[model samples]
Target: MSAPSPAPVSTLAPWPYPRWIAHRGAGKLAPENTLAAFRLGAQHGYRMFECDAKLSADGVPFLMHDATLDRTTNAAQVLSTTASNTGGDHPWSALAQLDAGSWHSRTHAGEPLPTLENMARYCIANGFFLNIEIKPTPGAEEKTGQVVGEHAARLWQGQAVLPLFSSFQPEALAGARATAPHIPRALLLDTLRNGWLDLARQLGCVAIVCNHALWDAALVAQVHGAGLRALSYTVNDDWAAQRLIHLETDGIITDRVDFFSPATP
Candidate 1:
């Protein structure tokens, strides 16, 4: 009799492989948060995508990296082009028309900013997971979190494809917890400050996403001790990636999805 085929591999946790993630969709390849960028990442074999989200004035959750539209879009120029587009600050009507992708490349010209709904639809339809960073504009933290959480709840309702919502704003995370209790949330830290674990626990975070440099073996173990997953950001090299793996980190967010040589496929 023919030998039985080897048992199927288990894709279980500490997860199935090393935690290499793509930052801002595929890094600087395609415009960040645009559908094109996500599609490009899939072509490169990425199963997870990360992007920033904030609320428009009308309370629509939309993808954007900056607090203002000046950097990634032609908002300022568009305002200059028409008197009607001019507003005191952050006028939603004017902000909506700015071509968010043109600044990245002429080829991506006229690509409009995408809504959270749009992004959710795309990710779910494509069998991809997401990391939605709740980036509130200055002084909009509580509202931004509540609105985005509600939107995320409605979008991912009754589906298994819930996005991992994250933010540096602790209050935002708390608000998200109140608004969408079912969605998983991560605590984002740019610095390794005292009392961070207290804050993370208070917010009910499932993971702590830090700037990789902020973590060493000790910190990774401490996080795990608290029953929290440890995730690092912007890790783009083999040595750094290996170090994190050795430290037993839960995930690594990287700009170079192309070079992430994980131990397993």
Candidate 2:
């Protein structure tokens, strides 16, 4: 079945992943993309987590969502000498020194940013699955994807389940596919632009993770018809989750690890 052709939804193969995914590790409970958030997510019985991985100045892959460090880490205080607050602006040596968790609350203070290797060890040892979003730095999209893909392959070598890499940038996905074709990839959509489905097909995506509101019965059917699984992100409300369930989408990424039960769905 071609990716753009419609087929029966029943033609779908068994999904290799869990239905529930914790966003940015534990979402708002702890600092985003930190190991502390992953631990909290595990406590909530979440088996899968969605993280943003990007490259540092020295080409090391680390887990951080934004291009800048000011929002989630203490780059302002730690790197005061230089007014630069971008994660990619400094090497991992400097990024590793900042406090990543203190911004969330007093209890989570002093948490350091986790390297992709740090995350891999933690997840592989605990039998957890990660959806690594190739959040590339501007002008370095393909390079970030290549570095992340290479590291993910090496780190998770000989493991049963590899990481599911997803990205909004097609170049990033292409780069990952080039370096590590064996790992599964997904196309993340905030909006369904013209020829978006074709884009997913060209990238050889195993699934489509869209903004939750973008899905409807027709869209779900179209994706399934093309022989791909449908997934959504940042889904927090009960009504929206129920709607996606009604559509029978394959995956749901949520920040509300506290509310959703991963074991149930």
Candidate 3:
């Protein structure tokens, strides 16, 4: 006997992303979600990056983690006091004029917020992988996911490693599935809720990105048992990284790009 055919070798979905992912581009090294940040991450030998994507008021998909620009951009000074503070309420043209880097540091004072198209071009040309988090505004989750999914599919055409889409919203993932079923997706959870695996299966996700604190060896095994990859986010410490490594996690999204050394397999 061949030992029962080695228990049939349960097959998992194909995982195209690298194990080490730079969070929000360079992870606080440069302005997050800007071309400069992506470039910085690459300079640090990072081949994979994670950034947030959302839709502008005019329906253009752009890179922005927050619903409002006031935190990352000079929106308070650029937009009229009466203007809506939400990033989704502004057109890309208006968004383009706001300084997205000054808030971080004076060294990057003039760096502009980059569109998803611009970021995609940069990443594709440089042979980098991307994890696009669909961070939609309230009530706009479905449309934002649809538009971002469509744009991502178009942008990454002919590329070997396709962008992986992830979101905390099931509605957003559902919309993405409707728009571009070919693109791989992941479900992001801050906490492991009841029936989370079922929900991930329903959304057709190839992976589940969880809060770093949530994963252990058993959980990782469970995720693998479900034929899905396990990934953890915002892992900024050595202990966390070591734990994930010990647990055989599939991916680690980190803010410590410089510290972690992406060259590590």
Candidate 4:
């Protein structure tokens, strides 16, 4: 028989992570990036979660999505007399005392921001997977990435699968890579700029996290062809989830933890 073309070498790498991930812990069901949200996600059977991580004035990596604490925390009240209410303007000691959960709802009132170390402990103890998105303050991109990456490396040293580090800022990814070269890193893409693929490769990313709408069959093949996994974020609806599944995208970050069973995915 004609030599069978060496069984097409599989482009897919060994992805140890689960297919489904909970967005900002439990998404809108609970306050984003709070430990309570993670607890609730676990209750709904989610094994993996994605959260935003940024540094405080003292450089402690903690969870919160916005640059200003105004939207998520009672910053206006807590920082009433302070010169600045920006999250990164305060030390973690001060940041921690702010009510992070009350903004979402009264039930989560008094919830404090969980440090990355605190998150590491919970996930490691419960055998959960995490994707930490390095969210840098305006002027602290590289520093935030370095700090978060260093902390993550130290925290999950012996874990089988280290937490994934992802960011839209290339410099942030570069910093993380410098600190924790062994931990897997992914490039977060909101839009396909020129030579995006080349940039991702340059950053040594194992995966590409994109907005759900940006994905299609050709793009999946393109990413796979480059030996990278294609992952989508904020995929909430059933139709979109089905589409990614159909296209064979490697991972899905979603707010609908209850709608999609992680156990089955």
| Candidates, ranked, TM-score | 4, 3, 2, 1
Rank by lDDT (best first): 2, 4, 3, 1
lDDT: worst 10-residue window of model 1: 9-18
What local lDDT score does residue 82 receive in model 4, on the 0 to 100 scale? 53
Q: Candidates' lDDT values, in order?
A: 0.80, 0.92, 0.91, 0.92
lDDT of 1 by residue, 1-265 (tens): 9999998653322333236567888888888888878877777888788899887766778888777666788876777653432122454666668797889999899988888888899888887788999998778888888998999999889886588989999888888988998888899999977899999888888789999888897898788878788899989777887788888788888778667743333
User: Model 4, residue 37: what's the lDDT?
Assistant: 97
Instruction: Give lDDT tens digits, candidate 2, residues 1-265.
Output: 6578674347676677899999999989989999999999999999999999999999999989899988998888879765677788889898889999889999999999999999999999999999999999899999988888899999999998888999999999999999999999999999999999999999999899999999999999899988899999889999999999999999999999999999865
lDDT score of residue 75 within candidate 4: 77
Best candidate, lDDT-wise?
Answer: 2
- Comparing 2 with 3 on lDDT, the higher-scoring candidate is 2
> Model 1 compared with the native: what TM-score?
0.87
Model 3, TM vs. native: 0.96
RMSD of each: 6.7, 4.1, 1.6, 1.3
In order of appearance, the predictions have TM-scores of: 0.87, 0.95, 0.96, 0.97
lDDT of 1 at 62: 82
Clashing pairs in 2: 7-225
Which segments of candidate 1 are over 4 A away from where they belong? 1-18, 80-93, 261-265
For residues 1-265, what per-residue lDDT tens digits would candidate 3 score against the true structure? 5545556576686677789999999998999999889889988889999999998899999989988888999999989999999999989899889898999999999999899999999989888999999999889999999999899889988888889999999999998898889899999999989999999999999999999999987898889998999999999999999999889899999988889987776
lDDT of 4 by residue, 74-169 (tens): 878877675586789899888988888998899999999999999999999999999999999888999988998899989999888899999999
